[model samples]
Target: MSAAHNASYLSRIKPGWKFGSLLVLSIGLYLISSWQVLLVAFILSVALLASARVDLKQLRAPLISIVIILGVVFILLGIQTNWLNAVSSVLRLLTMCLLAYSVSLSTRFSEMLELFQQVASPIRVVGGNPDQVALALSMTIRFIPELKKVYNEVREAQHARGLANNPLAVTVPLVIRSLKIADETAEALDARGFDSAPANH
Candidate 1:
């Protein structure tokens, strides 16, 4: 329950799932609607996200957008008494968010690239470079953690400057930092010869 202990616990997720256990657990929880199970999943997801163990930056934008959009829709589009659906939908989304976190935390980028290469082999045989695909995969895997770190640093700096509550202070810097990361990543890939295509002749 202590902050430090919680942080350490979050960082200690097992490197991979065994026997698709997370999936089975999720399914059982969904069917049972057990509050303890859902609560644990929510806590675990938050811990993983905050710890940057699962790398949720890639999901932040979409998740936020979905929440905002759905919040408005629920207020205006729904029958206003459809509370059950709203609760169910929100819980389902929270579970999905945790599921996504689990995937990134448990599955290594190398394993993902290997899977991609297997699927893209025919295309690679024609002209594509699996290496480039792998580079993209690496970036995708790294993108979340890197951006989340940047967001925290930027937010802290803003707070230090006494602009912590200013929306622009957070959003602008976050976007700028994300763009800068994307640019640098692209440059690194190019410098590493990842931009080169396979032989055309």
Candidate 2:
């Protein structure tokens, strides 16, 4: 998490409320077809991120990826349908991604884990381990940026070796490193007796 995110008012809001609102807003975005409304929603999402006071620099990589992906999406949709449809699709998706990222940035991992556990509690009735489920989800969310960092490091190293464009060279090391991290995490959880503990409601 960014220091700026910790200092923002959005950080003080409950994770459940922020996530709930994000879900509602995302659903609303999907239902609205007008490009004008979608554009406004995208603007509002940007404004929401601005209000959170998160450092834009931290978002550079993800923002770049989003732009590239959305550009491809726009082109494909325009080819299949109309340009207006492509515009609306891009705006709606971009808005949702921004809002989701904003929520993730502002909310702490502990808060997200607690919220996920609470939401997953009903799984216990079906003989499921809600704590494990919640932990898995939380860890997945928490490690996304870490994985991205690892990927960049691997890419940079490969680039330095003049193998930047070699898919196998990049992918082999990334997968190995990611699995190593996952194994370490599982061992740490086991040492903490996470599986032996009762679920916290």
Against the true structure, whose lDDT is highest? 2
lDDT of each residue in 91-120, candidate 2, tens digit only = 998899889888888887778868878887
What lDDT would each prediction earn against the true structure?
Answer: 0.63, 0.87
Write candidate 1's Cα lDDT for 1-201 as tens digits. 111222334334443342255567667656745455566666766665566544445566767887886677666534665755555555555766565655554455455445447767787657777777766776676788887888889889999999988999999989987888888877887788764666658
For model 2, the stretches where C-alpha displacement exceeds 4 angstroms are 1-5, 131-201
RMSD of each: 10.1, 6.0
At residue 87, candidate 1 shows an lDDT of 57
What TM-score would each prediction reach against the true structure?
A: 0.40, 0.67
